[model samples]
Target: MFAILIKIKAMRVLRITFFLFINAFYANAQYDFEKYPSIEYKDYDWETVKSDDGVTHKVIVPDFYINSESLILKINYYTEEAKDSEIYISGIKYKEDIPYTPIGLSSLRIADVNGDGLKDIKIISYYMGNGLASLNVKVIYFFQQANGGFIKIAYEDKMGDNRLERDFDGDGNFEIITMKIQGHKNHNYWLFNIYNFVNGKIENVNSKENYPIMVQILNRETFKITSKLSRQEMKQYQVNNLENYNN
Candidate 1:
């Protein structure tokens, strides 16, 4: 009878262990898009335009901002078949006459993001309000060729004061990092976020909250958080510790 009781106890423990393992596995599963807010893309009227670079571009003016200088353009390319062609969405920038700093077209960068050897375009744009006191809104767009047109594979938007991009995990792909001020007045707090382009979307892989007097770093591989006092002001804080964070 005692032997039977021991066997029954062992079976119960096994069942409980199996159930817990299953629960844990599901809990730590990949991110669910349904749980987050759906992304909304702005509508624009696209027009073909010829630029000084001697390349024809498909351009659009998003109504989000009233500034006429805000324009989005795509670069066209001919495919290997010689008959088919495609266009890649380039960036948002100002016209040549605009006095403001030219960002989109003038500052376009080409890089191989997916290790596919094909160059992709990286466009970063910002909405600067009035003067120094106004908060700036930034948007990053990454585009690649698809279906005879360009598709944005990764994008990130933030109302932060600064941004950074680098390969944080020793991977060929770059990570988008942003630092935002969360509090008001002189008692501001810093919120740092690290985003990775994964499975066609830019996902928040890690985040840190730092006091105004210190800097926080995350290990790109393990995501272990660490902090140190730097006495850097909130707006002045940048990703200066890449060596400590990147794997």
Candidate 2:
């Protein structure tokens, strides 16, 4: 009789949990996406910039850079001061205004980030407070268009221990691994944010994906991860894999 009673109680608990999950999902689904900001795009002549390079002295903020056969990036780097950068790709007549770069500039690279044949761009930059709690990390992506231009998307997360661009699954694709931490006074709640380019746009595709492969790769690579799961939790879980995440 006791066994039957325990089984009945277990079923009741499961039913309650199931209903709670369904209700939560419904509430989340009702949240309007219009409340959020759309993706940002940088308007410029990429063709000329792709084949240009040089140095110019500026009394103001300058386009300090890394050059490759396909692109000359002026990371628009600055710190402790507000400034604007004008990028004149070597001999090109056109100039584009790159936004004021953060003081937490980490690294930038060009590669086929979205699994597309064309090379894409990724930037990892972050700022922090005196303690572990104050983190403002940004992961930015510029998914290349077939016309040789790029679509820009930026995401924020707290855990940024692994700053290098890596294809954690070894499947010819790379993922932007970030995380979100909540709670007060170190009683933290973590959400793992896994991002990739899906159909020329950056999207979070955590569900319907093999997360273990990434965790295993990080373990093998010996990454120091604080927020174990990841960063921002989005409802639209995309499913795009990357390969050889490099520039």
Candidate 3:
């Protein structure tokens, strides 16, 4: 009789252990998109434009600022087939392709780079890898010319990294402000750097330290919080981060 009682106690303990394991696994499961509603913006129309090289490009023209000088277009093209991805900017073509692949690129800022009043283009690219799997997220930047051409600016391989075109130092020309991740641990911090374009060149300013990995430009001269580190908030965080850049 005592042996049977001992066996029953063991079985009860095993059942409790199994239940705890199941709950933990479910709690830590990868992010699900269905929980959030606002993030799923109905797909917008994509405009097809052909380049002189006989390549078909899918593009979308986002809304513009009132003082924008030139129209900015976000374009994507597959080199030979639809599998290998490539992105380009209308009006401004780079002398060469810039490294770093963005998941999506849109929302452009048009301003005069040299105070000529003719608009130049500044573009933001949201870089993220495949979802629900081992994903990667980063940002790529592009610039434009008064004659309506685009040039690559910078590329980063971590989430929340972005480019800002503003005269943060009261200078006449637009400066580039970017945030970068510097380490690889779970507690990795971010670094904010500033750059100025002189004679059509990009130079990095003083950059050191780590930030919260998420920031947003509220206006011409300020930034806002978009997200932080938490398992439940990742999807919302990514969606919010993407929307911030597009804006």
TM-scores of all predicted structures: 0.39, 0.46, 0.42
lDDT per residue, candidate 2, 1-247, as tens digits? 9999999999999999999997776555411111222222222322211212422222111222222343555543233231343332223223322323334554455556555566655555555545654565555566666664566665555645433334545555565655454443344433344565667555555553433221212212222223444423223222243221221
Stretch of 10 with least lDDT, candidate 3: 32-41
Off by over 4 Å in 3: 1-76, 79-103, 113-116, 130-154, 157-163, 184-187, 207-247
User: Which prediction has the highest TM-score against the true structure?
Assistant: 2
**Lowest-scoring 10 consecutive residues by lDDT in candidate 2?**
212-221
The lDDT of each candidate is 0.41, 0.44, 0.41
For model 1, the superposed segments whose C-alpha errors exceed 4 Å read 1-106, 114-116, 131-135, 145-149, 153-163, 184-186, 207-247
Q: Which of the two candidates, 1 or 3, achieves a greater TM-score against the reference? A: 3
lDDT of 1 by residue, 102-171 (tens): 2322244445554433344454434344653334433434444332233453222344322335454556
Q: How many backbone clashes does candidate 2 have?
A: 17
* Angstrom error at residue 224, model 1: 18
Q: Give residue 15's lDDT in candidate 1 (0 to 100).
A: 99
Give the TM-score (vs. native) of candidate 3.
0.42
Pairs that collide in candidate 1 are none
How far is 193's C-alpha from truth in model 3 (Å)?
Answer: 0.8
Candidate 1 overall lDDT versus native: 0.41
